[model samples]
Target chain A: MTAWQTKLTETFGDACKFETFRDNIRCDVRTERFLEVMKNLRAQGFDLLLDVTGIDYLHYPKAADRYGVVYSLVNTESGERAYIKVRLNDPDPAVPSVYSIWKGCDWMERETYDMFGIVFEGHPDLRRILMPEEFTSFPLRKDYPLRGRGERHNFPTVLRSDG
Target chain B: MPLAPAAQYPIDADETPDHEYLYTLNFGPQHPATHTTLRLILTLDGETIVKAVPDIGYLHSGFEKLGEDLDYNQYVTIVDRMNYISPICNEIAWHHSVEKLMGLELTPRCKYIRTIIAELARISDHLLCVGAAALDLGGITAFLYAFNMREKIYNIFERMAGQRFHPSYTRVGGLMFDVDDGWVSLIRTFIKDEFPKAHTDVARLLNRNKIFIDRTKGVGVLTKEEAINRSASGPVARASGVVRDVRKEEPYLAYKDLDFQVICGTGGDCASRYLVRMGEMNESAKIISQAVENIPSGPINIDVEDKLTVPDKSSTYRSIEGLIQHFELFMWNRRWKPPVNECYGATEAPNGELGFYLVSDGDGKAYRAKTRPPSFIHFSLFPHLIEGHAIGDVPAVLGSLNIIAAELDR
Candidate 1:
């Protein structure tokens, strides 16, 4: 095991479920320590924030959290990558912003906010990035209706080019 | 730091100042540079952009929400639509994520086929980028030349997969169907004949054109550190001399076996980025040529049990085992349930690093599926790059980013 893995195993032992897949160590950090783990990972040389996004898990039988915010980090020099997951309850899905550490997380975190309504506390400018501001509700949430209630009737008129 | 000329526009002393607060200029939901239905609400100070807050869900089709409703196998089609310009990348990324979770290894032949098709997709995507950049730079003829070539690549996709844009040709363990006979010969001919001519035309039309160079050179320069810090990948990062390629860094499919140079540019400007992509397209052509000639002869799919392999022709005509396995593979294949873990898999998408982070609950369906769309990140740097440049250069810079709204919104 590498130093980062050892440190990760020591810091969040048992609380952090560690597994290896495709040569990348995946650490499922406890929701509360998600930010701390990410901070530590960055200090330990995982400087690149490759991706930050969410997943909906409403259908799973024993799903502890209704949503998951997946953070993928990589050390550019060492080529060591880690996937750190933070699960959130459906009612109040939120996590601390990693944007402070990774500037790339700005848009990605906003995207998560846009799709799944997972708020990143302290995100520089958190807003709907891929949807109309007037639109109500997060579209990527599992319960969110794919086709709005009788909204098909509103399509022809509402869908006019915004020009 | 040279102040922009646009910043020099003087406020007239005689003109009556409106008492109204600074107005927010909604740039899109239909702006030409937005590429799709992206909307950016920019609070402006006269002509200077003050604060740019992007509002994006116009192109959202409830993909993640839809993922839950659809079966595992059926979801690949939806994934293909996420990045419409290079649907194959999306398809393969989704497939690899699920495959990783399931701990399934595809046959060598399947990997080679995937590599070939993926390179074709890259070529088509780069052609679109170069062509669109030229069009944005006011060279309509270059756009036509590039689009004509793109059409040929699309035709190849159509002939092979029977779909033009969103071909859900990739499956979890292998391809949805094997390549038809003589497809290799057709691809070989395309690589030898059509591909070079198109590239030559693109180069001749815009590569070093004075106006194009003046507009693109030294514009939107991202430093190597900034590119890495911003998690930029593919051509955008490569253009900045950051030698990070998912294929080269962490090999997948036949990338480990096949040989190709990792193209890089030290300039980190729009021109450098353009050249990098052009070079990459040529490299992709070479990879495809190599793949076609040396493709191994074997079953395209792994020798998995019937349940995980292929579906039966008709339920009424098939035996009970076939029906059971079909249901297992299609509807409820617990055997293919991924381990209770998470995996991040990225590919060299046309825009950048198209990665998929999957969380598996050791169940038939994915616990969570998160996509790391390159365009979304690349577009984040847009305001930063376009801030000080001339307004005329916005479209050229935007085109060079090669953002497909589907991926951006997804």
Candidate 2:
């Protein structure tokens, strides 16, 4: 294990599971314990949260995890990055929001929720961001049809009175 | 958090508050200064903005969803629309991520060529940002001066990639073609002769102008702490004195070898952001000149044996082997399949940190392709920065950030 991975594992104990890939460190944490780990990571100078995105593993037949939320964080001083990921099963894919830890994750969590239908428990404005508020479906899921479910045609046309 | 009148905030409730009411103002989904369809719902106490809430998603196109459907090679066309101002930067960034996923190292010549093109794209993107920002602040002369130079860069793009706007010129392993001698000379001329003169003209028109300075200075200040907290990047963060340039820190492509400076600003105002971008343009021109002079001569693409790169036209037309290689590359089933693990590859896009997070399920198509667009993060900082400022300063702030709507929505 690299020094950072060792530090993370030492800090978080069994909750931190490190996966190193191509000079990048990806630390997968237990869903319930991720918020605690994230707070500590924030205190440890992992200042900037780069992105928050969700991945559905329905198409990956061999994979055990059904849904995953990936948080890419960066140490602004060193430019070193790490990914904190949490896996969830079917029915309820929920994770604690990291908005309080890194304020940047507010919209990112909203975007993740908008696209993946992932319930962020403590997010202040937990609503659809990129998609319309009325839009029901999460278009980013692997099971979602590429051409869409004809939602574009469902809206009623509002023509101008003189037109 | 219910919408209320101004009287609620006053403790005494008798400080002449009954006559004053907070009214709502919508800046866009159609405002001219907002270069794209971005809606900002501002709670205004007369002219000064009390609070601001950005209502995005007006331009969401589901590009990430589209990326999952398209193959690694086929998705370059879709990525081009993310930042329309610097389409080649998007191409290079996408391909850079794709190549990282595939674990391919492009040739030395390919690196130099990409560095030159990417820097050109940066200059052009900054040119548009500076032009539009100045134009928004009623400086039409500077806008024309900047764009006149931008047209020459577009001409170079047209010559090199065959498209001025959405040049999907970058492939997974390398570029679509090599830069010819004439194209190189054109780029050299653009860097050496044209850019400095136009840059000076624009700078002279806006930099020290009293009206420009009065409107920009000490307005929409995003402090260094706030800049970091909001995860703002590129000139927005740099203007606030955040030393985070991906080209300087990460050094992808030929940037490590090339000589350039990551221009930063301490003022953190609209004027500072404008100055940072202007400084970056000069630095980009410097990098372009250095790269053009020292670009190594080698195969532009990875070797044909890799099967990830398209064969040259001469080879494809003259030899059956080259034809088969070309067919195999683009064929649906025969396209390259990467490992199942995921990797997040980022490039220092003109705006900021543009990253591509790709998850491959051991298939030709990516399982999940998430783009960390700089505009999205930068736009998130809008509400915080624009608060307590005059409504008219909205354009100045937004223009400085240079948020492309497509990128924000994507």
Candidate 3:
């Protein structure tokens, strides 16, 4: 096992399921223990939080949960990347925020909440980041239509050359 | 070193005991310094900003959603608009991620050509950032000098990929087409003769100018810890002395073989960021020249029978198998399919680490396409940097970050 895998398994024991595919290492942790794993990773030199994005596995039949939050972490010194994932069930599709660990997660978590509707518990300010404040739909959800629900048309056309 | 005249005097200290002393100022949604629709709600005490809340999302076009609807190849056109200043870099980054997911190995010629194009894009991008930052601080001559060099680079792009700005030049398997000797010579001339002169001219005009130095020296300084904690990348993090460049570390495309230096700045200020960008332009020139000189003479794309490689027009017209392959590649129902897996691929974009997180479901189209835009993270640091500094320093810092609005709001 690589140092990252060792570090993960040593920290979380059997709670961490480490897997490598095509040179990318991903560790699966439950939502309850996700924050603890992230804190450990940060302490273990995963200084850069590259990205925090959530995936909706509504169509995957084998998935145990409907939502999966992916945290792409990078150890800048070693140029090694680690991805930590936590699955959230539909009943409570929320996970603890990592804003305290990495300040970069502030907007990233909000964006995830805005798109996937997966709440980041304890996020300082969680709001719709890429959409309007009044917009009620999570446009990135699997059920959401690509053309949108006529909400885009409701806005006024402000610019027209003919006018 | 001294404060601006307005900041030297205090505002209403005790005049309004019942009222809020700090007045709010909406910096943008259409401000010149922002260059795009980025609104910062600032609570100002006279000239110094006490708090800044960046209100973004005006330019969000739901491109990520569109990625799910479009096929692997069809989404390249959409990715071009993410970072308009360096659209080719975005194209390369998107395809690099897609190629990684599909396990596509590019030809050596394609790799070298890609490195050259990407470096040219970087030079143009940094030139624009430095020039515009200088212009934002009342240096128009530097802007013109920088733009003139950028125009030469545009000519090279026009020669290679028919379009100057949105050159959807990169296809899934390889480039749309290959460049000839004329394009190579033009790029060589730009690197050898034109770009350096313009770079020097711009540097001479603003590098030691007292006004420029004073305005930018210590303005919006981000400590190394803050830069790393906030996940700042590219020149922004480098200026803060946090060593991380995807090109140097990740070694994508032809960067592993090419020789170049990673410029760093210790100041962590606007001036430091500016110097880092300027030094990077020089290094980019060096990399481009090296790649151009060592470009291998071979097929630009893989000579494969896969659906990812579009069949040549003559082959499609002459051979029945080519016709069938072409139809199968472009047909609505039957196209290239990806495995049910997810992959994250990133490149050292001019701004920072522009990453693409793709989730495929064994479909022709992506199930989930998430863009990890560096500008989004860089822009998040705006509120932190703008606070406790004079409002005038906003442009200097914003320019240093080079937060492309399209990428930030994508």
Candidate 4:
């Protein structure tokens, strides 16, 4: 185990499940302790928040959780990467925001909220970032069809002559 | 570094009496500074920018959603569209992720070829960014000089992959085709002669020019601590003296064998970014030259006996076994046997660290594919950089960040 992994597993016990794939040290944490775990990670030197994304595991073969929020963090000093994921259930999934730790998660959290309908509670601005304000459905969900649900056709067309 | 703010933003700390008079200026869906798509809501105190709200997603095409529908090989075409300036970077990064998920060890020859092409893509991307930044600041001669070499790069890629614009030349385990002696000479000719002349011309035109210096020297400064805290990478973060390059940090695709230095600058301004990119281009040329000379003479794709990749055209036409292998791989059922696991692989793309987070379910397509595009993260870092700068410095900062719209919103 890496230094942080040993520290976390000892303290949190069953809450932090460690898995290594390739070189990334992945730790899957339960949703409730996600924020606390992230805070600890921040203190442990995983300072660079490389990415924040969401995944819907509705029809997956091995998954027990319905939704997952992934945090791809990097320790700039050590050149190490850590992938921390938290399991959240289906209906209006919400997790505590990590904006307090890494200021970079502002857009990433908004994007997760935009694409998967997962909410980051206490996010300064949690509005839709990619899709239009009036657009309702979350597009990245597994149940959401590939061609979309006619939302593409709903926009009012404008001609160049109007200029 | 004189203008580097002590905090992330000092807009509230220096609350002057005229803070109430700050006016909002909508800076583009049409502004010349914002390329074609990026829009920023600049809350300006006369000319000084108090706060800049970058409005992206003007070119969102639901690429991650599209990744679900297309198979691993088929998604390269779409992936290339993300960072159009360095489309090959996207191709390599996507396939790198796929290769990692499958736990496939590429041949040494394939690794050398990928490194060469990847370095070429880096040069091409940096050239465009530098040239376009000059153009944005009205140095037409330097833009022409940079584009001249970029055309040579396009010709070389065209010769390599038979496509100029979006060469989807990368497969999961290998490249679309092998680089012949002629293609090798084209690159050798490029780095040794063509690239240097153009680079020198651009450097001479912009390096010590007073106008260029005045516009970019101290504008849009990102301090080292702020850059690291905000997860900035590539030339942007390196310019702030962060000294983190993914190629050096985590070596992949033959970078471990290559000799190249991570270029950095302490200024963290637009001018510093331009200089860092210039230094990186020279390093990229060094990488390509070395790899071209040492490219192992072997198969570019995985061995046909492994049934991991498609057979070559001549073999497929003549050999009966090749026909069956082709049919088994593409025509009938797909031959991908991936583990049901998740993997995140990243490349030191020219713009920054372009990474792909892939989750596999033993299916031909990915269950979820999330892209950590450099443009996305860097654009998020935009408001932080542009907070205390003037309205005129928007293009300088934005162009230095090199925010490819498709990549930003993907």
Candidate 5:
């Protein structure tokens, strides 16, 4: 293992599970400390923010605590890629925004906010991105209703009429 | 006193308030340049954009919510709909994520086939990007030329998968169907003869034209640091000198075996981004040629312990195993459950690094499937990119970003 991986494992210990697949190192960090770990990783040269996304786990009790926020980071020069998984529980799922550290997080954070409703604390403009402003629910959430909002405007008939 | 400057007006004068006077322009939801039904409410100051707030969700079909209710195998088709321009990458990324969690090793032949098809999709995506960009730049002639080539690529796709768009040809274990000899030759011919000429023609028509250059050269200048900071991927970042091609960096699906360059440009402006995508298309054509010429002879799919293969209709009557396999593979909740873990897989999508983050709670259905679409992120930077530019430059900047609204609004 490289120095950064070793440092991550030592710092988080049981809270952080480490897996090396292909050429990438994946660290599962506690959601509360996700921002801190990312900051540390950034300091250690994972400068590029490749992607940020949310994963729902309503199916299992183990993951039922909260949604998962996965951040993929890479160092442009070294070509080192790392996947950090942060678990956020349902009631107050919030993580500090890395937008301050990496500007790239601006959009990715908005997307996470849009899909899972996991608010990134300190995001400059946190708004519903993919969905409309009046959209009442987070569409990506497992428990969200898939069909029939009962509003006339929500009906496919309205769309057909417009077409 | 001589007529005081207009600024000396009383606070309660009968004049419109600054906020009310500002024009609220809706750019999309039905507008053609949006690429999809993405709606943006741009508050404009004269012709300059004051604030461009994107009002998306017009095309939100509850794909993620639907994924939760559907089984694993059934979700691949939904992924295809996320980025309609290049559905192959979506299928490949989802399949790869599932395969990773399941610890399934794809056959070498399957991997090669994936590379070929993915490159084809990349070429097709670049065709749309180039054609659409040209159209937005007011080069209707070049746009038509690029679309003409795009039509040929679409015809190839139709012949192979029986659908021009949303083929969903890639399956969990392997391809839904193998490439026949006819399809192989057609693709080979496209890569060798037709593809290069299209690139050349497009370049001749639009690349160095004074008007095209003037409109795009310095517009939407995102620096390398800014591009990376904004999580820009694919050509957007590459055009900014980020050199962050997921294929070259991560080496998923035989990209490691193939020799190709990660096309990069110094200028992070519209012109540089356009050129980078054009260069990438050339590279994609080269990759297709390599794959076609050196493709190995073997079964496209692996035989797993469970009946994971989709059975043919002809064998359903004669073979019980075929019938059972077909039922198991296609039936709801019968898809394989990957171990309880999370995996993130990214592909060098035409737009950018299209990623799929899947969380499996040891269930037949995905616990959570989040898509990291490049278009969404790229479009988010629009407010910053178009701030000082004129309304006329909006189309040029948007075209350069190649923001596919299907991916953005997904």
Candidate 6:
């Protein structure tokens, strides 16, 4: 973790805010500089894009940002991992897609978009993944009710006679 | 590794095929070779798969939404259903994330027990995959031999956790129940006798079988670069010569003490995937045997002063303080005072890296609980792997990928 932190501090000093949590490096990158920083990090040897998850901090006590898109990257060589977090304002939060860096993030980005309604700008195939194609609600959002809003009830029942 | 079987099985030159019209085929959604519910919308040129669009989400059960409502301990039930093949792995992964978030250190005994069970889960998961692959490729004998061994593992689980399939067996700081010597003996018996005999049986059955080799050898070849680019892990990536295993790379539980080689395959084909899983099952058995033999004697959970795990049954029944603690734990809840922070904890599950990214707001339940299921990422690799293969080769490739449908759509 220290190995990457020093290089990160030297390269993107003030641009990327660095912090440590539970033996891994976490950097807060601004939304505009997200793509550039990621491309640079890819060059820095974080080859594997482990995960892309979205967080809706609607009523969170700590975070000031409304939505958060977390990109977990790993350097398979040194076994080093770091998280690149880009915070965005609500009402159509968008972050540049890392699909250009790692083609594997395609489904992850789509899933994030499907859940948090956080659009991944420049994603190749951005669509709902875990939810139905016609689903209108972002189910994972804090505002979305747990039991659902009669979405399941509205589904056309296919009875035995109808079949 | 051989490329697609276009040379082996070509479009018949006898028929005058229309160039403009391509046959649209629905491979699955409900098919035996799919082994689960997932639809691959394939654009075909004769018998070859031109392109595949996997239509998933048939098993979306609002799992993440339910995570928001349930507390940390109660959410284990939902996690079990994520990768339902080896349900204990899901439980371990969920608790691993929660424990990391809450900064809890498990006891030595607990760590050893978890390591054994985790390896058991890995073995069980691989058996089902390998057995199903054999079954899909028309080798029922291997499948039967594999399931017989898997049933023994289930017996161990039933003895230890009281459930066979969906074992909600892990808690935040510890396990559901501590194992007795009888359970340890059962695990030892499986590891020593049942595992080796079954492994040998399946190896003998499929390793040299001409049909199995011909069907899987060159089918669905994935290069090391493509595997890395697609974020493939576990046996899938290892079979492609990507020497990355979360257990060896990031030592957790009792893995650091256990000695086992991270298996790698040179072929990067369906056959290599099968071989990698076969080699890994042996490694998992070795790990279990070592851990079971060197079992530690101590308490299973963290210190009671931490107030994380449930009190022992004896204390709960006998003592007044224990009853109140139980009452506070379930009824009042909201006892957690963890730091308002977030962490991503990953485990090298049987499939791949099963991780949980938890955001704690100093509350009982997670502010955000995002699961990083391996199958979801692996499913995306389908289009690339099955691009040029024949329709008949779909089962061989799919079985190698071992896409647990629920995990992919969860």
CA lDDT of each prediction against the hidden true structure: 0.79, 0.88, 0.89, 0.88, 0.79, 0.88
Alpha-carbon lDDT of model 6: 0.88
- Show where candidate 3 strays beyond 4 Å: A156-163, B1-19
Question: In model 6, which regions exceed 4 Å deviation?
Answer: A156-163, B1-19
The residue ranges of model 1 lying beyond 4 angstroms of the native Cα positions read: A9-17, A30-33, A56-59, A65-67, A89-93, A145-163, B1-25, B41-51, B311-324, B331-336, B361-364
- Interface RMSD values, listed in order for every candidate: 2.2, 1.1, 1.1, 0.8, 2.3, 0.9
- DockQ category of candidate 1: medium
Displacement of residue B407 (Cα, Å) in model 2 is 0.4
Clashes of 6: 0
- Model 6 alpha-carbon miss at residue A119, Å: 1.3
DockQ of the candidate models in sequence: 0.62, 0.74, 0.74, 0.79, 0.58, 0.80
Q: For residues B43-162, could you state the per-residue lDDT of candidate 5 as single tens digits? A: 888888888876666776767676766776678888888878778888898888777767777888899988988898888788788888888777788878878887888888888889
lDDT per residue, candidate 6, B316-381, as tens digits?
A: 999997877776677745456677899999999999999999988888888888899988888889
lDDT of 2 by residue, B200-267 (tens): 98888888999989889999898998888888888899999999998988889999998889899999
In DockQ, how does model 1 score against the reference complex?
0.62
DockQ of 6: 0.80
- Residue-level lDDT of model 3, residues B180-285, one tens digit each, is 9999899888988998889899889988999999999998899999999998988999999988888988898999998888899999999999999999999999
All models, RMSD in angstroms: 5.2, 3.6, 4.3, 5.9, 4.2, 5.0
lDDT at B171 for candidate 4?
A: 90
Q: How do the residues B256-298 of candidate 4 rate in per-residue lDDT, one tens digit apiece?
A: 9999999999999999999999999999999998999998887
Superposed by TM-score, candidate 4 places the C-alpha of residue B35 at a distance from the truth, in angstroms, of 1.5
| lDDT per residue as tens, model 2, A15-92 | 888887776689989987899888887877889988998999887858899899999988998778889999998788
Ordered from best to worst DockQ, the candidate numbers read 6, 4, 2, 3, 1, 5
lDDT of 5 at B137: 70
Isolated chain B TM-score per model: 0.90, 0.94, 0.95, 0.93, 0.92, 0.94
